[model samples]
Target: MKTLLSTIFSLLILAVPFFAQGQQTLLLVGGGQRPQEALKEWVKANPAKEPKVLIITWASANKKQAYETSIQADLREIGVRQFLFSQDITNSFEKNEFVNNLSQATHIFFSGGSQTLIMNILNSDPQLMNQLQHAYWKNNIPVAGTSAGTAVQAELMITGDTKNLEYGLGFLPKTVIDQHFFKRGREDRLRSFMKQAPGNFTGIGVDEDGSILFKRDPKTKEFNSTVLGSKNIMVIGPEINQFRQEKILRPTLLCSQLF
Candidate 1:
């Protein structure tokens, strides 16, 4: 796993020159409610320089205008003005339109709901998926997601119900995120993922009000994570060699209040 992480880190450094901008940022929020500190940081990042924002609600079951309106009002309170809303993508035109629209967005956020729904929609349209990749990878737009929205950002996504882990949008290729961590006892599923993951992937378990902030260094190609909100962030990685009693710990998960 360490070797895999090293290889990926090296690759990211090499690929830095290909991107139009410098650094990429991601904010992953745990399910339920957003913490005040996380919300404050998100709002502060919303400068006039990057005014355009896209909010995706496809994961949300309540795809009504009222729900969107409520979200808009909350964002507006934080000084956000320009906005684009996406509830569903059915036709080719909408899909194409979404791809084109991403070019103008400075920030993109996915709302909370079912991760499966978001994956199904994104996978159904290859163009949309490609466009999103370009927007974040090359364009340097910051992407944020909550709940199921956070889950889909990993390459290996938890199905929520099943013990299996399937493909996700994978914005954070090296990490897998789970929401409502301690409250719902989802650590076991994450352990299952670590056991079955194809490559070196870090498992991040977030409490209902917790969030994980990720930033990539353009020069060194290193990634740093900071834990925010109340509660704690759980990190699970490859088993380490411990020569205490010759007892090999099968699963090694660490819990910390901060990253």
Candidate 2:
């Protein structure tokens, strides 16, 4: 009996690391007013007592400084002191600096602007992309993004003009994410994109002043999303019957769906 109990304890100890690795966290905010509550929730996701945040404003062109200032104010309001910003990839030196910052960050954030521009820059550099992936995936750092930042988290990015589609950072697999969802009247646009999107990808449309926290379960290895803030998050999936005239199906899930 003593040997059997010892073997059970050893097996449980071996499972600890695998279980912790399966849990990944993402905080995606829709464009507009970022509620203090949402930012606080993001802070809580970090395991460190005082997380060092690295804000990447690659999506914004000339407004990078302005975006950083606003986000810095918010972070300070939440009692986050160790925060830094980086943007504008003009030379190899700047790109390398950004990659190095990724390694140091306990939590990484992306600010709002143009998703097209964000992907354009990320796609240009293989090293930068790999490092960002390593920081979030292998290192298990929590990632947060707002607006265009949120849109780039998915594999299929919905450009403001739904007619044109582009590849994103692919952080969220088999999903298409759109921001400023209902405020911009993008329901039809998202549906149209979902209908045309290959492989029956899921569509997540986030309204203004709202956010979704996606947490991957260790036991099931599936993501459970929790809605936060004042607005709604619309999730669209494929219809059960492929032969049906309407291939896209929008479920009745709303803010009530919890993690």
Candidate 3:
């Protein structure tokens, strides 16, 4: 326990130099499927250190040993070595153990499940969240999430219901992310958020087997987003409210493509 705390402290101390580098990269995948291309890109992007991928399954309710074994085997077939799976987390020891693993991680992947469950657990444990932020933003490690995992990355988290979005970890501000968009017919729900939003916020909706890769240009300091996988990625918002009489009009939404 003492050694674990010391390791975390050392990692935080070492991250000071890279703290201002901005977001490293983000791969957000819609629920219902996992795209192999996204995983390949994530592995290829890590030139900082040895490629070590950690999978967090806190959002998942059932703890199946076979699930972990299968995922590990699949990732291995695609050139990913050094794989780790963490689930059913409850105490500081478990959280600290996860933090220790982050020290060597080149990428972190969050599995699909309930967005609310993800937030409730992470929020209650700031220590774990802080370490995540340090590894992602400070240490410049890439991170990916699918389904509910994708939704929790936005500042305003869509609850997959008509109710207002809950506060998220805010990894990506000025954006609201929803998964299984077309598959679950969630376009109407995303529209509701825009209609009621006081300030303009971008809504990113990804369908099953689809994902978006977000990266910052090292030279220009600008962010670029690209679509990946076989399906479409929808981008809405930057809402333009032109009031004609009592009605408001917003620009038509569109989808984009990528190689």
Which candidate number maximizes lDDT?
2
Kindly list the per-residue Cα lDDT of model 1 for residues 62-103, writing each as its tens digit: 754654675566667656788887888888777766776676
58-134 per-residue lDDT for model 3 (tens digits)? 77677436446655665676688887767756877877778777786778887777878788887887777787877
Segments in model 1 whose C-alpha atoms lie over 4 Å from true places: 1-21, 43-47, 64-67, 241-259
| Better TM-score candidate (2, 3) | 2
- Output the number of the TM-score-best candidate: 2
Query: What CA root-mean-square deviation does each model show from the true structure?
Result: 7.6, 9.7, 10.3
Rank by lDDT, highest first.
2, 1, 3
lDDT per residue, candidate 2, 92-195, as tens digits? 88887887777688888899999888888878887777778777766778888999999999888888654766788777766788889889888888877777
Report how far residue 144 has shifted in candidate 1, in Å. 0.5
- Whole-model Cα lDDT per candidate? 0.67, 0.72, 0.66
- Displacement of residue 211 (Cα, Å) in model 2 is 0.6
